[model samples]
Target: MRPILSALLLVVAAGAVAQPVAPGQRLDGIAAVVGEQVVLYSEVDALVQQTTQGREAPPDLWSRALDRLVDQRIVIARARQDTTLNVTDDIVSQRVDQQVAQLAAQVGGEPQLVQAYGRSIDEIKVSVREDVRDELLLQQYQGRRMREVKVTPGEVRDWFDRIPESERPEVPELVRVAHIVKIPASDEAGEARVRAFAETLRDSILAEQATIEDLANRYSDDPGNTNRDGTQNGGLYTTLRLTDLEPRFQAAAAAAEPGDISPVFETPFGYHVLRVNSRDGNRISFNHILLQVEVGEDEAEAARETLSVLRDSIQAGTPFEAIARRHSEEPQSAARGGYVSVPQTRQRDLSAEGLGPQWRATIDTLEVGEISEPAPVTLADAEGTQAFHIVLLQKRTPAHPLSVTDDYALLSQYALQEKQNEVLQEWVDDLRETVYVDIRAEQYQPPAGG
Candidate 1:
């Protein structure tokens, strides 16, 4: 029984059918009463304007919306009967705040948000929170309803057969790739020197001798934390999730409380010390300074020589996966037999963009199952730090029609959703009979019929 849903029940049937009138011209009246909830004509007019943004709508829009509102009220009432489903006001408030923060960022921050939205930050939050709560409740009900639905292969095939042959999907060229990557690290002496510098900065911040930001400006090698003024941030990052952070960073963040400094830690990006500014739920906002170890020409040459030996071994007899596991510096792919994979569910095509000029050229020349000549490439790693790696290409595919052999997962997902939608529709229909739904019959009349 949200205010927005209750208000839209009463539009003049004749005027709406002929064409839309300006908002001021609409008369308010009750369209239906559901249990204790009432629907109003002006609300319908406002909703049509809100939904279509004042564009022309079909004459029966108000009636159709009224029917939908009645159905929604039924589902909502049913959800209320099941006492275990609980969404708190604070959770709704947080969601609304997060949404507003995102909008504020898009419009050049909060001052501009007021300009674009014609409302203050607090005003917008107050208005949207109830609507957000309603959405969350509906989502919870539907999510619980569909949780155990699992579609089978036979069902997927049946779904595909129903589509016309001319309308079945064609797939893009898909490629499977494997690689070996190596990064240069300074000799032990150079690494020790960098680690010592990071330790010194941590001590300095602790003693209040100098700020983490000042130290970052002088020494942090990461390219991602630069300000608009071209000065480096002391790695001040906000709204970060610990799980999304690198293991070393996550551990450091978790071990410290707000206003406490984390012990120095090592990540591929560099050695670092973090100062926690705030913690909210599972997210943290923090400042830190990194001191990256600089590897010299000797280190780079040693890395290249090592990769050359690895390439020669793969050609001679050794399996690529075994050699990559022993030596590949690209941590993620190295563990997975050197394979470069798209998220199996997200994409089927791996476009050739940004693989570096060397990788792009090597991939283009290779046939399926052919290995590329060992090549030098620079990789921008997860922390936005750069390292040089030697690479290999393993497989490529040409464009082809989608089939059970190549696209089972995608087809199964589509069939599953269709089944879920049908189940949800039936659930809604069942709810209609049990609820006290009063659609005002006299309000919607047929034109003089033959």
Candidate 2:
């Protein structure tokens, strides 16, 4: 049975739900019937396009799409009957605004977004509001389902005891790890060069050596306002508070008197030089340029050396968890004493898989309670942020059957999951019986009683 609590609804697009038919294009039709609601072929097509991106369609993709739509319709229909799932327009508007902001960031600016989508921001909102409403309804229903689920200790132990020893599954070998992470400091020389660049831009604007429009167009990485004629409106930020600007940029702008160029300042995005054009109370209008810098390797070796010293302290009997909580930069595992969870998580099933191949090889040789020397690993993000980690392998466990003695805690969790899944399945089966689901497509139809 499919998971009933999953939130996998399609994110609606900026245009009409159905795509406009091109010349010689085939007309779309209804794909399924879910009670009073008709599932459109176009709706399924949009979702399939979103998930698959530009890739070739997977086998039974249509069936999977139909199944999701049916599940959503079932949940939504039931939700409308319940008075507890009330969601106001304001709440959905906030969600819409956040989604739009994300899209703006993704595309760089509002003007570029409008050009790309061929729709104004208001038009995009009207298209997405229906989707947001249905999603919020389903969220409330899932919350109610979770609140009604209860598990007891006796239920956990009884479930574990009934599983035959020979038939129990073997878990993969696993390691628990804690880590301290640090990024190298930005290069001082490069930073100075950037500051100088910002100052030059600021000086040019101040002396009227170059117009704000010219300097902003030539130098600023900040997205400039665009006109229909495709000309930028330049570095001017109208009606913004000093606080609205980034801290480093704000401080510089606040210090400078109106009509003077502020001292160049640095921010994560780049170096900035602000010229306050006017001030009214706390709000100000200003123009600025951003000069991006690159800094990943600077001071990296120093950070590694610091972590190595920390590991030595742990080796000398300092409690790993306490040290991690106090000093470790990897927040998730440090709070739990540096333990990285293994996949074999049931009672007696403590295991980890696919640590970097090199890390795994070394971890295989270490026993429980032993610590592996800091192995160097580089992590880079989508924004080109690069950092190094000094990892501590805190604990190791072998694959084994359910153990009443060592794995009681894990067994309790395992039992709880099993109980929840079983309860949720029964709920879904009941929902299916109440719904008027008709799968018109042959391959997409559900089996009887399924």
Candidate 3:
């Protein structure tokens, strides 16, 4: 779940209450005041309820939630004053649409979602749009603040030294690896077969022989068109932006009107026959039937052969990075000269346990600086699509005590985070001093365990 969607859910859930109070009467009291904004007691209660979720609430929960709300208001006030910060309507609209779609899916559909939330879809969107903007503003402000923080090598060493020798954490066995990936080529015959199937589905829908939903349930290969429990989603996608889609798919949809069927089109994923359910400018709601060509054993073998030749060339003095850049099919690894970093982290080093069984077995016997023979594996970020790759084990460090000299990259990340937190605390303190703040709620105090 995205933060925005989660937030929307919480807000929607909290606001669904019905009260007998007069329209002009305030149902909730103010918990705090930060600058021009007030944090309501209801808001604090909502957050505490979410955090506790029926678990016994701690004594300080309300105070902590109030503190968080006040801090957010302070930051939001600062963001509003900054001329440089902008969260455009388009961005807000797209995010709100995504949240709606996700929430709608969970609650059965848009109508069900509207009924559950006690608001029309448009009203629901209007309610959460500003919240989305605020969240985005907070993200932008925090990003800018964190960017200003930096750590020196001396700081990293000092951070490591501060940890007493007896308390030093043991380093796990880590492997830094690289690979040249080759997606199996789609044979001409297979492509023709898949395209023909897509055309047939398009024709069937056009002739009223079948509904798009029925065909999608039976044949659509797109994983996004399915729910987790093996139920089909009828291939529905809501408020899809043109730029977010595959180029050919986007082009096909762009040329079509609402209720018009797109001609069978090919994207990197498969051949698609799409129906534009509706369109509002560059954003469209659509249903699609996708048919993918399967790779035969011969095609898989050919990919392996290509990697085998590249492996030989690399072993015979050609640079692995150069060859990987030219021929590796996986975009992220290829862009980094085939070095596969741990996802969402800047560090290339990965613990052995983090590597999936397939990869661990592939590199189990490989020595440092040696390249393995081409082996079958699933490509990353490719939806478990089978591909072949040749691995290069760059460096492998056995489990040992943490040391500044051997683990500078790891130590540097922790040090940088520590410095960033210090900077953020000082900056927030400065903001609180300048900003007008009043607390009507009880202040949070740590429990005696501290």
Candidate 4:
């Protein structure tokens, strides 16, 4: 059987439910009530419309959508009562801001978003905050409960045994690889120049030679300081939580009192000189000037040379993993001996077709146990920074029928999912007994004991 509770359905992009139309403009009414929560007819209709996307609705589609919504309401209602599952106000506000920002970006800007939504950005934020909170609560509860469900080795073997030989699936061509990435190191001279420039800007602000805003508008390298319409923000960030800042930047900003000009500090992006404009409890407003160190041809070539040396070391039988652990610049992968897995998943073997063109092309030419020459590859860094790396193709498995011996991980995943589904169903069944669920819509039946 399928899982009882599906992933929460977010309506109208990031839980920004459509506003009610003017009175008599359209028909709307409550579809059901789960404890104190009311489910709107329009909510169910909107989900059905989104899922169908102009295609013909299958039988019982509306009822199925309502069931999903009811399940969410029941879960959220119960989760809210659990003190351990409490979602904090700060977290909710942060999520609300993030969703609004995303929505504004998708619509071109805050102004465009206001025009489309028929309300101010602040009003829109208020309207969506509760919905975002509910979604987060549902997610938190699901994660907590699902983490308790696990599958054993015997369960995995049994799941594989139940599948007939003729019905077994094919495993795609997968490769396991490790890499030693070297980002171009900044030259001391270039870094010193940036530091000097940052210090000079800070001094100018302190001595009243120039205002920080003016200098930031003129020289700050942070793109966030610029607006979409060619206007500069003067490096002003308002109502920012320390948690939203880069760790190093947060430390520097936290040390300064309101109206203090901080000493020049360095983060991965580069040097910064911060001026705390104001502070209110945990919220702060600040203006800053940033100077990014430029990476020139010499720096790039030096990184390539370093990777070349590491490649030679690995070829000379000085274990690839040992060299990677000591020198790989990407912290997370370096900790795992430079083993790069599929993002967000624990699987080490990756499908060649899913890899980026650069990685796929480079790995295609190398035999198992062969290390490729140092070559330029894009780092997964936020800035898409260019870097050099030497890749070792550790294992390459060609397409074959899935087998218990060769595909245990994949089988284990299937077994775990099945177990989690059954557990979730039991949890939902228990909730139905305790929660008061009333369905008033025609042609829909109230669940037993609900």
Candidate 5:
């Protein structure tokens, strides 16, 4: 989330709430004021915490965050002065719901989410609503103030031409290729065997023969836990993507309630079982045991041979799309005829980067219709080494300089963004002049007297 959006939303939601000072409660002191709105130490602290929740921030982050909050409040206060800029409840509500949905998706599910945030779903919804309302108000104000802002084609061309050849945006060499994935399923006997193992483990835990943590260290499929205590410290299980777990594991995890231990479940990987430790909003903290399926060397060799034959058949005239639809285990891309759209340019170097180097090297050298030999590539999936690919290049675009005919959309976006920045800077300046702003003396003190 952007700092501007986060700060503005916080103000919208929590700003209007009555601040009743209790005798015992400590106050952090006021940082700044915009009209009736006051930026307090507590508010700034909250903003900083939210902004830096999952990431590292610099030492001056709090000061920068405070400045941004002050600016946002100023913008909102100025906008509210114009009665025409009043935001609607419907628009605010819709934006709030969208943001909430996105957050919910990130955490896992609603019940799990409540546990994580220590707040009910309704409370979260209300907070989101308030934040979104302020955001919409700010947007509306921006629109009204910058309605006439425009950039001409000549300006865009000039901007493009100003850049030297070395500085010009380089188009990435992209590959358009499709794939078919086949994941072999574990047999029913295999599943039953894994289930019995889970039940035995569960009995041992119940009987004091072993602890859940000890079992997790020995049996958990999660690499994060397999070597140490099976437990992922501090409810980290929610962060795991559903696609990263075996289908059966995902099903069990999704169905299990906080404190509930699930029976053994079978997946392509083998058999497993899990226990949900806690639920926070959409995120669930859980622990599991993994019984990996054992494949004979011959079986592994046969699977590779099968992929080789499929690759040959495609090269010999079998339609790639038909082959993928019939045999591909990857449900997501198989339906699209195995076409994975590559980005125009990658940031990493091709020669020494991990997957980055391989991708960059392969796409750069291969022409259309050429199929790379069946490479023993790692699966870019949770099922891990079970699936591999023999990539057939479908289309390739060479690197080139930007042009109006070929990159009008990109250039237009750049032009619009430049115009928007100008409008925003002007708005900020105008607000600074109109609003009553006072900076603390300590904020601008010189390092030392000359």
Candidate 6:
């Protein structure tokens, strides 16, 4: 979700709910009242503190937050009257769990989180659960209210054209490449050594010689698991995105089942023995012990020699993609003929520049058929470890301003959002009229322009 919308939702949902005063506490005064719900000064104060936490906020942030809260409460009261927008308990519970886990991770862990908030985990869970439910309910109500919003093609084109040339979207150079990979096998003795080590650890766990937490702390290669006492955080399993994890680890993880322990598997970095702790849908939680395969001077020379030979083969008319698929140890990109899709074009598009930087730089330096110099890159494993990669740039594109013909999808989204916002505002206005809202005279000042 967009950050602006998320903040707006948080303000609305939290503002509408009454904060419980401690038994011995005295109330200063009411801030506002919407229908039967009264907003307290303390509530407004809490919102101000939350909004300003870790950063400086605008001078009128409290007033702005209060206004947003009023708009939200009005809409929420009307939503309750509609009776068609009931958010389920299960959905609320899941959202609550996700938020709680995120909050816990952000604060280091549950114990630290409890200390910071002065609330037990269970208490925090209950509060966060209600907050999630309220937020979800408001979102559902807003979505249903704006269901008929539509943006025409003409509108999209108009918006595209209205964007000033200086402000127009720029398309960066992008490359498309593919490759095949082959990971070198560990020597027989090395494989046997790792297998024996895993068996011993398993036996120890079975015999109560050591706990899973102990083994994970001492030997698990995944740092994420180590922090959680060898447990998967939040009971959520990791999703196998090639970008987020090593290709070999992703492949092995994707294939394993809950409670399945994999035999020693070799990848470019080292040999790993993985144990799948749990699986929920496509998410899999796993523990692993990684043994670094010693690459002595001779071994390093040999591997470099092999890569040089592979590079030569590509130059000698063997397709880079074919060679990558056939011999590259980088499983993630090799299987796709070494093509790494432009990050900005992906669905979520979490790229740092929002699809503007990385590809643009590469496009400037690379050509369609030429390969780039071998560059060192780090590939993260399922447990989040740095595995090295010798990345070759095989493709590139030039930067150009966006056009309607070439950027229709992006323009269409902008058009759709514009239409939705207009409809949502009208809906909110209608709800405000229906809901009985009474703001304290001092707190009811309109915006400066208004």
1-450: candidate 6 lDDT, tens digit per residue: 001122233224344223333223344467779987656664565465555553666777767677776777676566556667778788878877787677666544686556545688788878666556656766787766566677788999888878888887677533444433323333566657765776787677657797555665677554454343544432123433221245456556655666665655665545665667765433356666665543244444555566667777778897777777777676666666666554323322223233334333433455556554443233323332222223355534345578888667667876877777677767777777878888883743322222
Q: Which residue runs does candidate 5 get wrong by more than 4 Å? A: 1-30, 38-60, 91-124, 143-149, 157-171, 175-217, 223-395, 400-416, 436-450
Q: What tens digits encode model 4's per-residue C-alpha lDDT throughout 1-450?
A: 011223442211211122233223244567789999877765665566556655877767777777777777888888888889878999999988998887666544687567545689899889877777777788888788888888888999999999998999888899998899999976889999999989989999999999999999999999989998999999999866553366557667767888989999887778999999976544579999889988778999999888888888777889888899999998778989999886656689888767688898889889998999887888877546678888989899998999989999988987887787788767877998999999877754322111
Count of residue pairs whose backbone atoms collide, per candidate: 6, 6, 0, 0, 17, 18
Q: What is candidate 2's CA lDDT for residue 306?
A: 70
Model 3 root mean square deviation, Cα atoms = 11.0
TM-scores vs. true structure, each candidate = 0.46, 0.54, 0.56, 0.54, 0.51, 0.48
Query: lDDT of candidate 1 vs native?
Result: 0.66
Winning model by lDDT: 4
Relative to the true structure, candidate 3 reaches a TM of 0.56
How does each model score on lDDT? 0.66, 0.63, 0.76, 0.77, 0.60, 0.57
Q: Candidate 2, clashing residue pairs?
A: 174-351, 174-352, 177-338, 177-340, 178-338, 344-349
| Candidates sorted by TM-score, best first | 3, 4, 2, 5, 6, 1
Expressed as tens digits, the lDDT of each residue in 259-324 for candidate 5 is 766777665455566778865433356766666665445555656677789988987899988888
Model 6, global lDDT = 0.57
Error of 2 at 392 (Å): 4.2
- In candidate 4, position 109 carries an lDDT of 68
Summarize candidate 2's per-residue lDDT along 1-450 as a digit string, tens digits: 001122422211211144333233345667778777677665565456555655777766656766666666776677766787778889989987887777666555676456545579888778777677766777787657856776687887788778887776665665666566656677888878878877778777778888766777777777554545877767777756443354445556656788777677665577777778887644578877667776645477776677778779888988877777877665555666655554234222234555555556656666666665555544422333445555565556676665756566777776766776677656766888998888776643322111
Candidate 2 vs. true structure, TM-score = 0.54
Error of 4 at 217 (Å): 42
Per-model RMSD to reference:
15.3, 13.5, 11.0, 12.9, 9.5, 13.8
lDDT of 4: 0.77
Candidate 1 lDDT over 234-338, as tens digits, reads 778886644446655665676788988777878766788888898765557888877777777787787777778888888898998898798888877788877
Better of 5 and 6 by TM-score: 5
